[model samples]
Target: MKNTMAEDKIVADKTIATKVIEKLREDIINNRFETGSRITIKEISERYGVSPMPVREAFRTLEGEHLLEINPYKGATVLRIDEQFVRDVYGVLRALECLLYETALDEIDQGVIQKLRCINEQIRAIVDLPYGAAEYVDLNTKFHSTIMEHSKNQKALEMYTHYHEIISTIRKKYIPVPERIRTGIEQHEKLIEALEKKDVLLVKMAVDEHIKSALENFMTQFSQGK
Candidate 1:
């Protein structure tokens, strides 16, 4: 009975930690907690009506994402997001996406192609809506995920999903800008064309260029803002 109770408690703490991680991830990304802002386990625990144990677990995860720095003496602090941070995130994103596409080539069928085409149509139509950035991110994520989901590499797919969440948040934040959106749609169309031809070389080129263009557009806008 004691063992079962302990296991249940562990599960409960993990559930609470996941909730806290989600809330805190978005909060930090959206600048609710500005860069260099300090956060303590006790404060977050009280705010979320949870215990310090779960909050501590969440802090470890946020730190892993490079959004926070954990200090043994000073609790946690939000990290500065700069050009280097963007590059590092997108760099891994590019590699993972390229690998996903490579592995998915054997699995690419008419069904996946049609799904991407359908999503592309939605992307085109979304621009007409007054507020569609969030939806756009969803569609974009769906589009990539549909391709990446075919990979036999469970580990890479999981990491891809995690990184893609961060990418979507950044994209959603910049949704008002037409430049990045338009460029993305164009590359996506190119990717579909390459996929249709089953030209491995072109597919590789298309995916590589797609990531490059996204990084370029993000850098341009991010630099101008700074």
Candidate 2:
């Protein structure tokens, strides 16, 4: 009975740790933890009402995701924004998005294009309101994710998701300004036009330009501390 109980406890601990990790991951991705903030195991354990072991395990998992940096005595701090990291990620994303557009041109249907158009329109409607930055960010993610889903390339989808996770972190720190937001909407509309026309070359160019322009704007703001 003692051995059986110990095994059950171990299993429970693992489950609890996984749950904590997932919850914390969401919080981090959602920018709940302020940029450059430290995350202590004790605080996490207290907040989640879990043991230190689970909190530590959760931290380790986040660390692996490049979302946290663990110091020997200082505990964990959210990773700082790296401009080069964003540049490299966006570069890769541009290339992959172009490839996805080409491959998905024939496979993409009117329904998917219409869905994207709706999302874009919704994004436009909210661009001038309070908290519009956050809403735009979410809508932008949904728009790109929807496109990737229709790409029908499992490997490409996986790669895109990985890059997207990192990009989400960067975006939270530097939400685009109103002008950039307007430009992004325009670019998205052009992308939809390209898709509707089934012009693979045009779609690819539009996607690349959209991403490149966004990246440039983000880097400029990041440098200027806007």
Candidate 3:
């Protein structure tokens, strides 16, 4: 009976840790925790109604993703968004996205195009609605992720997803202004038009321009402390 009870406790501990890790991951990516804010294992345990062990496990997991920085005797804090990190992410993304477009030009099926169109419509509807900063951020991520999904390059897709996760974290800190959102919507519409025409060159140019514009906007906001 003692041994059985110990095994059950271990299983329960693992389950709780997994749940905590997942929740913390989402919170960090969604920017619920501000950069440089301290996150205590005890606080997370209380918030999630779990034991400290699970919360500690969660922190370790997030630390591995560079989303959290853990210091002995000091606890964990959200990682700062570095401009170099953003440049590295976007640099890789541009190359992969361009490659995806080039390869997809020859292989993009009707089904994929239809799915992309559907996502664009959803983004359009979201933009038209009265939304808060958080809603706009979420919609903006969905819009870019949807395009990557149709690229059909598994390695490129994985890298793009990771890059977007980093970008999402940054966006939460400096929410894009309403004007940027409007410009993004217009750019999305134009990209869709380019896709419809099956013009890979046009699609690549539009994507690169859109990413560059976003990077510039982010830098401007960072400088202004918005």
TM-score of each: 0.84, 0.68, 0.61
Please tell me which predicted candidate would have the highest TM-score against the true structure. Answer: 1
The candidates, ranked best first by TM-score, are 1, 2, 3
State, as a TM-score between 0 and 1, how close model 2 is to the true structure: 0.68
Ranking by lDDT: 2, 1, 3
- Model 3 worst lDDT window (10 residues): 1-10
Off by over 4 Å in 3: 1-80, 107-115, 125-128
Better of 1 and 3 by TM-score: 1
What local lDDT does model 2 show for residue 70? 92
Quantify all predictions' global Cα lDDT against the true fold.
Answer: 0.78, 0.79, 0.71
Candidate 2: which stretches are off by over 4 Å? 1-81
After the best TM-score superposition of candidate 2, give how far the Cα of residue 68 lies from its true spot, in angstroms: 9.2
Give the CA lDDT, 0 to 100, for residue 33 in model 3: 76
Error of 1 at 195 (Å): 2.2
Higher-lDDT candidate among 1 and 3? 1
Q: What is the lDDT of residue 219 in candidate 2?
A: 88
In Å, residue 83's CA in model 2 sits off its true spot by 2.5
Per-residue lDDT over 1-226 for candidate 1, one digit per residue giving the tens place of the 0 to 100 score? 1122222232343578787777677677767677898999987777666789988988998889898999997899899878888888898888888787877888889888999999988888886576666677778878888888888888888898788777666554664455566677888999988887777788889988988887887788777765
Model 2 agreement with the true structure over 1-81: per-residue lDDT tens digits: 112222223234358977777667656765667778887888777666678998899888778767799987787998754
Error of 3 at 44 (Å): 11
